[model samples]
Target chain A: MALIEVEKEGKDMAGTQEKQPVRVRGFPFYPHFLLREVVVMCIVIGSILMLSSLFPAGLLKPADPFDTPSPIFPEWYYLYVFGFLKFWTFDVGPIPAKIIGVTLPMVVWYGLLIMVPFIDRNPSTELKDRKFAVGMGIVVLLGILYFTYYSIVNH
Target chain B: MNLPDMIYKWFDDRFKISELLPPIVKHPAPEKVTSNPLYCLGGTAFLCFLILAGSGIFLAFYYKPTPEEAYKSVEHIMTAVPMGSLIRSIHHWTANLMIAAVSLHMIRVYFMGAYKNPRELNWVVGVLLFLVATTFGFSGYLLPWDQLAFWATKIGTGIAGSIPVMGPYISLILLGGTDITADTMTRFYAIHVLILPAAIIVLLGVHFMMVRIQGISGRL
Candidate 1:
């Protein structure tokens, strides 16, 4: 009888703990709508709308497809590719800088990408297991940053 | 209960859905959540795309996409519109930045082996998204109707014509004619402003839902 009572008491305590309500007080304000996505969307849209309001109302000249402007360059995004041509100013160099600048980095990036499933043989959750992947990611990220900055600054 | 009260109660019951499911329902099992700070890159890319869509809509309100008036409209937006140049620059920069971010995100996934096993299809979807994004870039490049746009598009369309068996057919379809004429701009405008956007919306939905279902493929 004593043993039965002890077990019953323990079960009662467990049930109470399980049923206890959690109080979500003092937490940061999380907006009902998607907070981050909404904020970002607003910034981007607002900036463009703001730009539209400033357009030269009567300054529009007729479009002529044949008229090419001086220093004709693609949009800012293509600046990287434009900058890439600068690096490719040789016929045969070590690594073919253009290939390395554009194609080879792409090859290595995508090649390493395709081989990932095979290379990551371990299923461990430890950070040590992911060190190589993380290291490679840092290198690639830094390279991209270098390219983007160079595009903007040099151009 | 009265009819109105009954309807209210029904609505309230339907809304209280968390009460229906068992509290501890588990299927795939909870994996350890990642503490990686860089995981936010995906979120950032998603955010930027949303921004692009909103801004593009606003731009569309005033944008006239014709070889006759495209450049003028862009110029008007720049000189007359308040902060127009800044907006254009931001949108332009963001589009490029987004491509970089998505590429980086894909690379991160690849290196982390997150693209293996059950995630292979997601990787394929990602490749399609990349292709669509490049097309978006290409189409948008011509919207300004500038010199670079004219020549670059001429070269690009010419490449389409060089595709061997269906080269001429492909070029004709893309150009809507033999040369870089008004028809070409119109087709590209429709593609830029309509088709790609719709495709992107659908694909983004799929990609995001898959991510949610699979729950960030880390430590797998």
Candidate 2:
């Protein structure tokens, strides 16, 4: 508050001759903001270095079409889709289980995700005001987590 | 004046550096953003991306896209080339870290309601970038042509092929045929090195520009 007052006073003192640029309330972007970013970058790079050295990337044998490995998995991020496919057993009317399984995670899930801002018409950013949206976000997050776990454990 | 000052003045005379510096140099980052750790996620992801790009270029120097030579090339890189193993490891870790950071950044944006109002387009761009990043991982996964790479891609393409309507076409475009072959390796290599990098650069530009124009959610 005091800093803003000083800026306001500084602006007024400039009068009509040399107007001061309207400064936003916060630390200057130069050394202050970028310094923090550099710090975070260093930390991130250091962790990656440690992790890479500790457990280097693995390599399996050359690909042989005839030899299929048991319990083959996609990348970890896609595990939820794999899990959902395995979990869903029943058919929805005319649509087969496979179609629904693939469509639900890949199509419907991403479609809803892409449409979130539109779907959530509420303009409020506060947590208390957005119970429904927050609740839905939690539900989706938990669902993904559950499925990722399911994909690994069941297989 | 010093040599550096002379050089700076030469460019300043031509470019009007003083006028160009104010908007960005004068503007301050919001207090909430600087103080909060959650705000770091997006920048962290960007940093990871830079590392991946550097390390990936190094790995690419020795990597082969052909089916027969691809595995051997990677093996040679791991065993023979100087610091090749370390570079490959760095690339691997940075790629995973980038995906994790991107996901966490999305969660932060969602929870903070930063995706609402004027920032909606930016949010969409963010989602697109996430897709591109994951697609980058998927394409790179198949490049080594090892057993794991081959089978994982087989499963991945199979899953895409199972999607209704556009499923088969997407698979066809991805695999370049009915099955994974030499063509598939080349396609994945091209997508990983060329297509996705171009997409990511454009998307990132839009994303950053939107944030600059709209400002962070803390202001609202």
Candidate 3:
């Protein structure tokens, strides 16, 4: 596709027209993006309101530091990390199990995610062309699902 | 011509909203990117964040930060104050939904390879935004001062405390001491309402700006 060249008047006294190349891009933001956003906003707000009314959040008894609860777990999002820590109990020689378990998975998971664009230098954006990237993504997704399930069941 | 026009002209002369906004509103997005509904998850997450912010502000009116009165205040909000329960519930559920939406958005970005080249920095910013949003959840979870909240925080911080040499110091910083005290509750409350929200808002601004500048990535 040819780049679209747009002409604009320059700020100099000559008032010369400068040609700038504009990348032919997506749909216009006004009606396309804005209208869809409005609809999504309404749906999200409406559903949340409906859900809240149907099932109000319950307050448990006041926190007691003296009495520790059994099977304490963080929110669902952190359950994968929790489960990873639980499963990787073996120590690596001098390193403590907790440190290795916590740091390793975090480093690997976050490292891979944050480093994706840098690591995958392939030019093609196609899925088939990026088999390794797609496979890795699927692996991470399944790992999260499995670990979350394990954390819940074991807890 | 009229009062409204005069006011608009005045503002436009000062702020240049008329000159600036049209280009942004009329920005072009790839047809392939715009066709897919999956690409909208980030906006959905942002919408949920807006709801959470509104409901959270409403909840804050009745919430107390002290250990002695925190639970009582929450109970009052839930039982005594009109629409308090609904507001609190919406805040809670929307937080979870935001996390879900962000996760799905990240996944879509990943599978679509939208993080390539000029968009790399935005991806990093996105990851930071995700972390800040979850931290918002963790901090806000403790505000109720309920049994589950206490235990969950204890374990969550305990996990943090397992970070080798920096563990103890990190725990100290998070708890504001050795244990979960009134100080800890106050700290969490401040972080939730002040620090995380500020960070998230700034990061969101950058993320959106980057997306606008780079344009949406083409479909696979």
lDDT of 2 by residue, B72-139 (tens): 99999999999898889999999999999999999999988999998888888998999999999999
Residue-by-residue lDDT tens digits, candidate 3, A9-108: 1112113222554445555666666777787788888988888889878888889989988877788899998888888889889988878778866656
TM-score, chain B, each candidate: 0.85, 0.98, 0.95
Docking class of 3: medium
TM-score, one value per model = 0.62, 0.95, 0.91
Which one wins on DockQ?
A: 2
Candidate 2 chain B least-lDDT 10 residues: B22-31
User: Interface RMSD for each candidate model?
Assistant: 8.1, 1.8, 3.5
Residue A29 in candidate 1, Cα distance off native in Å: 13
**Model 1 over residues A78-125: C-alpha lDDT tens digits?**
555545545455656455544444543333445565555556666643
**What are the runs in model 1 whose C-alpha is more than 4 Å off?**
A1-72, A75-155, B1-35, B82-86, B163-169
Task: Choose the strongest candidate by TM-score.
Answer: 2
Error of 3 at B103 (Å): 0.5
Native contacts retained by candidate 3: 0.82
